[model samples]
Target: MPTKPSVLFVCVHNAGRSQMAAAFLAHLAGDRVEVRSAGSAPADQVNPAVVEAMGEAGIDLAHARPKVLTTDAVHASDVVVTMGCGDACPVFPGKRYLDWSLADPAGQDVRGVRPIRDEIERHVRDLLTELGVETEGVETGGVETETEPRA
Candidate 1:
């Protein structure tokens, strides 16, 4: 059996995008990947709107925390995904990195944040493929995960 890959998603604040990404990762990857998410600056709680949107998609992230990003999280992952962190994210060698330029959902309501949320879902779907997680239904947005390790 192929070994499960470990992944970390990072954002400025763990309240929105990263939370959603982490939720999708956990949902689609299931038992296939060790997934986590953190933020350069974590908020006290998850953005409620994000939680609601994810809930609508049949995923529950109510237990997800807004964790502060640490060097340990970076060291623990083979792949680190960043969104809107620019220069605040840590750098590590011998690991793959991906930057997702999705808009921040900090202040947006569900209607306004849906586009960003959908984009994240698309990216998450593609990421699952990259990690070799088999899943159907691709009505999220547009991103695609890696199917195999890059050659």
Candidate 2:
């Protein structure tokens, strides 16, 4: 089989937006893509509201943790998506980079996080299509095993 396309999502804190985006990508793309997420400045844990939001979509993110961004991660990925990470994420030639200006779910409740989660799902779906992966009726599940929460 051909190698799977890899994506890395980065944000200031891996606590909210990035976490949701990463989870959604994995849930939608399954094992067809290599999903990874990290923070420019790692947090102790993922934001509680983010965990709850993902649970609503049937993906458990309670076991996920924040990871510090690294050059290796940027090098390994075919795409590097930034979410409010600014200049923290190094830019490399030949890598597809996208900056998603998503609202931070840091202090928001589950209700407030829902919209952010939905937006992320839409972005993830579009991304899968850009990668040439079919999303028409793919079975959805947590792609956590293939993703390293602390990468």
Put down candidate 1 lDDT per residue, 1-151, tens digits, no spaces.
6778999999988999999998788877676789889999899999987887666666777887899999999999999999987788999899899999888888877765666677888888888888777766533323323322212
By summed lDDT, the worst window of 10 consecutive residues in model 2 runs over: 142-151
Once fitted onto the true fold, the runs of candidate 2 whose alpha carbons sit more than 4 angstroms away are 139-151
lDDT of 1 at 106: 86
Model 1: CA > 4 A from native: 136-151
Residue 24 shift from truth in candidate 1, angstroms: 0.3
Clash total of candidate 2: 0
* CA-only RMSD, every prediction: 7.2, 6.7
lDDT of 2 by residue, 8-121 (tens): 999999989889888888877888899999999989999998897788677789999999999999999999999999988899999999999888898988877877777787
Q: TM-score of every model? A: 0.86, 0.89
Residue 79 of model 1, lDDT score: 94
Q: Residue 84 in model 2: shift from native, Å?
A: 0.3
